[model samples]
Target: MLKAKAIRIREPGGPEVLELGEVELSAPGPSQVLVEVAAAGLNRADCLQRRGFYPAPPGVPADVPGLEFAGLVESVGNEVSDWKPGDRVMGIVGGGSMTTRLVTEGAELMSVPAQLSLEEAAAVPEAFLTAYDAVVLQGGLRAGQTVLLHAVASGVGTAGIQIATAVGASSVGTSRSAHKLPRCTGLGLTHAVLVEDGRFADNVLAAVPNGADVILDTIGAAYLSQNIKVIAKQGRLIVIGLMGGVKAELALGALLAKRASIHGSVLRSRSSKEKAELTKSFIDQMLGKLESGELKPIVDEVMEMADVRSAHERMDSNETFGKLVLRW
Candidate 1:
């Protein structure tokens, strides 16, 4: 048995409940790869999981928690020829990432771009893949169009801005921070609106003047009604988070008048085949941006594996502008 250190919930409530301990890890299965985790990213989903609002997908151990990581391949299982020992990779999984070593789906792993550090690479998959699926796959963001992204300083938010730019689409990003607003602006976002200062609709519409061709939002029900007002004809609104609340009243007239569509996505709920497809698309379409330095992972805070509790605190308090990673 290999002893691996991990953070777990001992009855969830808050970050303080994240207990660190050593556990015995088993060897990889035929379709799995054992990775010595170099870094693991913290996400809003992590907080939800810690609060008992989320759990590992079926078949994953209920006690473990985490969704993504960057690491070296310690060993490859049979029939996994695309990777071998010593290879650096990043990938997403059901959970169990809060460990020194863990198992991952062999097919989900992607080669880390040469220019990226392991910790930075750890921050890549969940945010970027999620943003990619929303903006490109479902939202139909196109070149010469415009997009509005809420919580634009988040991991997925920042990723959305870079992706919008890479696809030749102009973007207006929103944040509560006047200070952190510049980071999104630095990514070539067409507009940076301070959400705390006022409503985002004005800034977003002012940038495009008509309305946003696409709205990539994580605010959920809080912005549901307002989103309907800002979306252009046949526009797309993709909601990926529900930080404010889960239910809202919608104006059916607005929907009929604009002919717009709303899409809600959760990456963890996807099937293995679906995940594989998304991973392939992201690698094929997004890797070049990383290689060209047009897209980069945003890492806000990094902590030692033992300090998982503190990492959770920073994320929960909204103290971070980008991804917070835990290094093993």
Candidate 2:
């Protein structure tokens, strides 16, 4: 048996609940690759899962608690191609990411953009791909269009700003802390606000004057009604997460008047087939932007796998800007 160190949910609760343990696993199955993980990205879903909110897929391990990783291939099962031992890559997984090694189907990966270090690539796949899908693919973002990103300093939010700029679109980002707003400015964010400072709608409207052509919101129900009021005619609003709460009341009148559309997406619950398609599409469409440094992943901190409890605290508290990584 091969044994690896992993972070597990001792029980659903706070940061204190994550336990560092050893787990046994079999070798990769056909069409799968075993990656020797260098680092794993901590996502909000990990926090949610740890809180007993996000359910584990059937047959998937319940304890392991991370969504994505970047590493070198250690082995490849039969029928795999486009990868071999020692290849550098980053990819998403159903779970079990915070470990020394992970098993992923062959189609779930892409070669890492050459210049990115494992440390940085840890921030790539989940946040960047999710942002790319929301801002570029689904929203049909085009040059001169305006985008509004809630949680400007977050991993997905920052990625949206850089990618929007890379695509020649403009972006406005909002954060709850005014102090964190400046950190996002260098990425070409047009306007940034502290939700505590004033009304986000007013700040957004003032910045664009014409209202947002696209809005990427994670705040969910909390911002649902307000987003409808400011979205431009024929605009697209893509909601990726609902940190605030899920249930929302809507004003259909405003939605009808503006001719805006709202979309909700969850990457984790999607089938393996859908995820493979998303990963490949992202590699094709977003690779150039990453290669040119037009789009970048922001990494706030990296800590030892042993310190996962503390890492979870920082993520759950939402004190940091960008991705938090755990190194093995």
Candidate 3:
């Protein structure tokens, strides 16, 4: 058995519940690899899990709350041949990534881009992967199309802007704060809407005229109706978070008239096989852009593993623009 320091939650309630302590880990199983974690990215889901709202998926360590990590390979199981000790990797997991070391299936890992630091790499897997899947694959965003993204300065929103730019699409983004809009312009945001009292649809429509071909929403119920109003014919609306409340009354008539589609996505609950497939797709599509600096991780802050509580507090306060990385 190997011993490592990890942030474990004694009982889910608040950021104060997170505790740093020693934990035991067994050797990797066949097809798995052991990684010496260098950094882990903080997500809104981590805050939700810490508050007892979102539980880790079955088979994940419920007490350990983290979704993405970047690290060096320490060991590999007998069945793993593609990766060996010393390989640099970054990837997403269901949980248990808030530790000094972790075991994950070799197929689930992505080789860290040569240009990125481990802290930068830690911010990529979750944000980029989620944005790519929603905007490109599911939303069927094509070149010259228009996309509107909520929470404009967020990790995923910044990623979407870059991805859309790389593919020759235009993006309009909305944020509650007017200050964040300026920062997003550097990421290729074509339009920035400052949402006041939940009014953004008019600005989005004004920017695009024909309406957005895709809407990537992090705020749920609060933005649903407005999203519907601003989406183009046959547009795809992908909801990946519920920063707002969950339940909302929908305008089915408008939805049908526009022939729009809405999808809800959560990466953590996906099966290992599904995650591996997405990771492979991401590598094929976005790795080159990442290497060439066309795409980059937008990190808001970095903290030590011992400062996990403060990290959570920052995210909870909604003051962060991009990812908050925790270095081990």
Candidate 4:
């Protein structure tokens, strides 16, 4: 067994409840790899987990809250042949990623692009995978199409903007912070809409006229009706987070008239096999862009792991323009 230092949630409450602690890890089983984590990305989901709203999936440490990590492979299980000690890797996990060491399936790992540092790589897996899976794979975004992304300065939103641009599609992004919109525009966002009082459908229409071919939404129920109003005929709306609210009346008439579809996605709750498939798809489709600098993780800041509480507070307050990476 190996001992690892990690951030633990003392209880269901605020950032003050977080503390540093130690956990034990067994040797990697066959097909698994042990990693020395360099850094981990801080997501809003981590904040939710700390507040007792999101629980880690079964088999993961319920008290440890992290969803993505970047690290150096320390050892590979006997049956694992694709990686060796010292290889730089990054990927998503169900939880328990904010630690000095972790064990996971080798198949889940992606090589850290030579163009990116480990801290930058820590911000890649979760945001890029979520955006690629939601925007390209499920949304079926095509060349000449337009995608409307809510929370446009978020990690996923920034990644979505670049993905849309890389695929020859245009992107219109929304944000309550006008200061952040210019960064999104510099990242290839074709249009920026400053949403005021949750009213953006008219502005979205004004930008695209015909409406968006795809809408990647993180603010769930609160934006449902407006999403329906802004969707183009046969548009696909992919909902990946419920930051706004969970319960709202759906406008069935508007949905039916537009012939649109809505998909709710969560990466952490997925089965290992399903996540591996998604990782493979992302690597095949998007990894080269990351390697070539065509697409990059837009990291808002990197902080020491000891400052995790502040990181969580920043995310909860919606002050970050992109991802926050925490390193031990």
In terms of lDDT, which candidate is strongest?
Answer: 4
lDDT of 2 by residue, 157-178 (tens): 9999888888888898988887
lDDT of each: 0.87, 0.87, 0.93, 0.95
TM-score ranking, high to low = 4, 3, 2, 1
Weakest ten-residue segment in model 2 by summed lDDT:
190-199
TM-score of 2: 0.96
Itemize residue pairs with steric clashes in candidate 1: none
List the candidates ranked by lDDT, beginning with the highest.
4, 3, 2, 1
> Distance from true position, residue 57, model 4, in Å?
0.9
Tell how far residue 65 is off in model 1, in angstroms. Answer: 2.0
Flag the better candidate by TM-score, 1 or 4. 4
Off by over 4 Å in 3: none
Candidate 1 regions exceeding 4 Å error are 1-3
List where candidate 4 sits over 4 angstroms from the true fold: none
**Residue 118, model 4: Cα distance from true site in angstroms:** 0.5
lDDT of 1 by residue, 1-328 (tens): 7788888788879878888877787788898899999999988888888899888789775777888999999998897898999999999887888788988778889999999999999999999999999999999999999889999999999999999989999998888778888878887778888875346777667767778889988888887887888899999999988886899999989988999998888898688788888999998999888877899999987888778888888888898987998888
Candidate 4: count of backbone clashes, pairs at least 3 residues apart or interchain: 0
Tens-place lDDT per residue, model 3, 1-328, is 9888889998978889999987788999999999999999998888888888999999898889899999999999999998999999999999989999999999999999888999999999999999999999989899989999999899999999999999999999999988889999977899999999989999888889999999999999998899999999999999998988899999999999999999988888999999999989999989888999999999998899899999998998889998999998
Model 2: runs farther than 4 Å from truth? none
Q: What lDDT score goes with residue 115 in model 3?
A: 84
